[model samples]
Target: MNALILVADDEADMEPLFRQQFRRDIKAGRFDLVFTTSARQALRIIGDAGQHDILLLLSDINMPEMSGLDLLARAKAARPNLPIIMVTAYGDADTRRRALAGGADGLLPKPIDFPALRVEINRCLAQWGAGP
Candidate 1:
């Protein structure tokens, strides 16, 4: 089964990095990626991607248009059971607290641990009853 993942981050470098990191999964059609730069775009994708087999929503806490924490709340309101994860360059306690409070399933600090992210994605998929 294909697992679609929606990612929201302002960094222009993330697309290449993610495409490189999950090259196999993406090429084999096991994972499909949709990249966006802002929270607004991410929310629109969330609303539209619901019909697909969306596995997770990954967003950066710090963004230009809107914060990922706010996106988390809006996404949750759109899809209560959606498993959303927050990533940020800042690993501060307050940011984490806000993310959790806003209904994020996981909080990851940047530079992202790719290995750990893979594990977390699978774990999130399993929790949502979707095999990784």
Candidate 2:
């Protein structure tokens, strides 16, 4: 099965940028992209589509109703093996600790560096023995 990646962020604008940045990888059959603008929407998407192809989740730290940490906890509870990476504008030791303690597989600071994101995703996939 093709690797599936879920991007969850409240900012609608980031969706296109994520698609654009990952387009090459996507076209190369590296991943299938799924997107949601809120944690609740993400949860629904995950619940509905997660069992099939989803391999990873990328989420922003802050959102309207639910935070990324909450999303991570819920997602992990539902799918323990699904890798989750949290993105935040505020990257501090404390925040990183919380993310890690919350079960994030990785953390990224925003104004997201796509190269780094790709690298981290690759690393995570490799660690899980899920990467091509």
* Per-residue lDDT over 1-132 for candidate 1, one digit per residue giving the tens place of the 0 to 100 score: 567788999987999999999998788776788899999988887788546667889999889978888899999998898888899999889988889988998899998999989998778768766667
Best by TM-score: 1
1 in model 2: Cα distance from truth in Å?
4.0
Off by over 4 Å in 2: 49-51, 124-132
lDDT of 2: 0.86
| Deviation (Å) of 59 in candidate 2 | 0.6
Q: Model 2: which ten-residue window has the lowest total lDDT?
A: 46-55
Clashing pairs in 2: none
The residue-by-residue lDDT of candidate 2 on 15-114, one tens digit each, is 8998898888889887788888999988887787535567789999999999999999999988888889999999999999999999998899999988
> Each model's number of backbone clashes?
0, 0
lDDT of 2 at 114: 87
